[model samples]
Target chain A: MSGTLNEARLMALYHNPSAASELDRAIAQDPAAAALVAEWRRQDAALGALYGPVGQEPVPARLRDIILQAETPANLPRSPWQIAAAAGILITFGASLGFGGSVLVARSGASPSLVADALRAHETYVVEVRHPVEVAGSDAQHLQAWLNKRVGMSFTPPILTDYGYNLLGGRIVPVDQGAAALLMYENAEGARITLYIAAEPGQGETAFRFDQEDGVQSVWWIDGGLGCAVTGDLPREALRAIGTEAYDQILPAET
Target chain B: MAVLDEIEAAIPALRRYAIALLRDRDAADDLVQDALERAVRRRADLRGEGKVLSWLFAILLNLVRDRHRHLTRSAHLVPIEAAADQGLPPAQDGSLALTEVHAAMGRLPLDQRAVLLLVALEGRSLAEAARALGVTEGTAASRLGRARAALRVATGRDRQTGTGGES
Candidate 1:
């Protein structure tokens, strides 16, 4: 019970029957130790029985879709006509408004494409009834932690209850630069709003720029290397208030 | 394209590991989905020599660790009783024993539980488990030893007393 049958040797034997030759000989001689090994083997077998079939179960459609979509040619570079069309669309609706005394010095970065992606994500996900978000709002802590790590920024989903919106949940969407976090909220009337955050490396602060396309309104800005946009179908003033509140909460105080 | 196929092939094992870790099928699939997303996004960074399965597991273990830290900080532990019956096989004669073992697994420290699952259930070598866990082989072996010992003690108590202690 005390000598060669230490826990380490026993574990090595458990993992590999041929791991320790001397330990095998010792277990054969020691009945008590041999009994312990037998018990562990039985337990291990039970563990196998309990979990082995989980792998054999069909992989969920969502999981398979992720792999399939990642390989699609849709992510390839856009044609010149496509770029011109996008720019024309943005110019028609984009309105740059200066915030008096609150605007930090502006720096160059890719905000236009980020906004486009965020708006597209909002349109795509907000319409889904069965799966609005990847992680549900009831599991807020897990969702926040996951977004923080994957999106490479620390942020808390702003409390929108004061604005009559409750958190529906959030998902990680891919962007041109990296991953973006999209948080969705719903009001009593079933209207939804989404907040999108992505890293805009080396980007400087800017006043909120409002954009409207196909009746969907958005307020987007860059502060402290992070680009954020709040998109919804609400009126411009209402969306601005919510977006401003989110900006105040999500931006680090020192920044 | 080949990497995507490899990812598809590894899905079953990943699901198995996640289910064993989280118990709840929905939560496990969520974890698998997140891992797959991360893997596809970072696939270009994958070196030629690294095995795709191990790389995927490493990503998953990192996510699991993050979740545990978040849960600990929020003090919102998944209710053991509510989660106990999830994804379990239909009860047979040994159902009680299986339940006892399942409950005991929920009690093991996260690190120990992970080591046990990787080695015992997944049939991984100690070194391979260590690689996936980002730990030294020696550390992984010691964790497995402690996990097995803890499991035995927990299940043994249930057998002797007819009812197991609740956490």
Candidate 2:
């Protein structure tokens, strides 16, 4: 059967069922289309049965909490007090700028504010299979150059061969400083991790802060004038070792 | 009566779609929660012409695609064998070839998988699936064909398998 006619036949069975009889008659002229439709129906039935239970299962409590929290006044249309609080926080950061580097500090590690953005980005991008990075890992130099150009910081993709993670690629992200960058890496086991960097000129050095959500672990720190966060699903010890090594390689180069 | 109530009614189906796509319960709920939250945040943007369920499914599908975009190609794994017997049909429903189907579905590519789930499993009309994915009906049809063919090969059940041209 010609490709177009064969497609029309199969499509007739699958989508445009009103025309299925005509297509089936044409498909009967070709056994291939009929067999294909049969198999497709079987597969569809299987898919329906396998996943249908999940919807019937009890909804997880955490999901409800997520919705409830998202609906809270702070996250929804910000209440007047919430808007004023945001203004206060911005003014606080602006005032902190006067302090010398290493003096302007947060409650802990990379500041409390940046942690949320880093976590959110980690959640969003780490699940991507294709187009994970704007520049593919095959061209490490281009990935670095692209991120550097977009983020206005000379950043290098850390070599994590020792830790079993090679550079997958990098992309530019938004931060309070206008631009940030993230380089994702994956190991032989297929576990993905990323290192996020932002220019924190004149900001204080950070004590490493760690966070975990949905089985993924993350660590953030500041070295020199750059604020960095490294996040993944690795064990705390392993993630820290990798984060520390990356810090040694990239941050020290800037100093 | 209310848009949110309408949205609440669709949660089970949305959750089912998410689970079929991700194959993980927590991950599926996470996706469902994200869709619902986005719906609330962008409530003003939804026009009455669009059904709340369709709009919510669109959001869930987008989130799945976003996850697909950042995830590595090597990480696709389906433990269909273990989970195969989890869905035993009631005595009258008859035996189902669910495990084989799931394994095959899991091995298929994401785009194909999405098209198949929306149409074959979810009972979404071809045009509705196309609208949800923001693709033409023909594109949706083409994806479905490829998806079905791919499943046949993956399942090793391509009985009467004439030379396949995926037409």
What is the per-residue lDDT of model 2 for residues A127-193, given as tens digits with 9 covering 90 to 100? 6675566677789777777666455556677888999998888765555545567788898888889
- Model 1 segments beyond 4 Å from truth? A17-26, A82-255, B48-50, B70-77, B81-96, B157-167
Q: B1-167, model 2: which lDDT tens digit per residue?
A: 26655665677888888777776667777888888888877867888854887788788888877875533243256565546457555322322355666666667677777778888767777888888888888888888877876766666655453534333
DockQ of each: 0.28, 0.25
Worst 10 residues of 2 chain A by lDDT: A69-78
TM-score of 1: 0.53
Show pairs that collide, candidate 2: A6-B167, A7-B167, A102-A204, A127-B71, A128-B69, A128-B70, A128-B71, A129-B68, A129-B71
Please provide, for model 1 over A4-51, each residue's C-alpha lDDT reduced to its tens digit, 9 standing for 90 to 100. Answer: 576676666667745767657767887656656665666777788778
The model with the greatest lDDT is 1
TM-score (chain B) for candidate 2 is 0.82
Candidate 1 lDDT over residue span B122-157, tens digit each: 877787889999999889998887787777776663
lDDT of each: 0.75, 0.67
